[model samples]
Target: MANGWAPDGAVQDQIDDTVKDAVLRARGMMPSGDGSDECDDCGEDIPAARRAALPGTRRCVACQAKRDATLRSVGINRRGSKDSQLR
Candidate 1:
């Protein structure tokens, strides 16, 4: 039931790849170990609440927010479609 030239399961494969990519991206964004008591970026004390909530956090709230903003600004599209590449 694939459209055009795609073979059967092609669409499903694409969907699976997209989902895998998203999962990997999310995992990469998460901290790995116990969160530090101090911000890695600014040397400020990382709040206990934040450390408790995000176990691997390395930055203070403000630094984390800034880093998030910066990351958001650099948009990543995992679709890898020809149309997307053209743009």
Candidate 2:
């Protein structure tokens, strides 16, 4: 069933696009490339095991935990909800 101004699959397309965008965003957050021997935030030495385990880590566990703690949810509702808009 087609809705006003949209084709049959328009809503589904939006959902797929949103999922794709979220996947891309999460992938971008992951560390990549040849990482560091030390923490990027602190001067603490990154362990060999951790470096090998994560493959591309720049921060030690403690510093990374602090950084993760400060992260906030910035997601926006693309579905046009009044509650989301108010926030």
TM-score of 2: 0.71
Q: Give lDDT tens digits, candidate 1, residues 1-87.
A: 987787888878878877787788888888987668889999999888888888988999899888888875334455567987999
Top-scoring candidate (TM-score): 1
Candidate that scores best on lDDT: 2
Candidate 2 lDDT over residue span 10-51, tens digit each: 888878888888888878888999899999898899999999
Each candidate's TM vs. the true structure? 0.72, 0.71
For model 2, what is the alpha-carbon lDDT of residue 84? 77
Whole-structure CA lDDT of model 1: 0.81
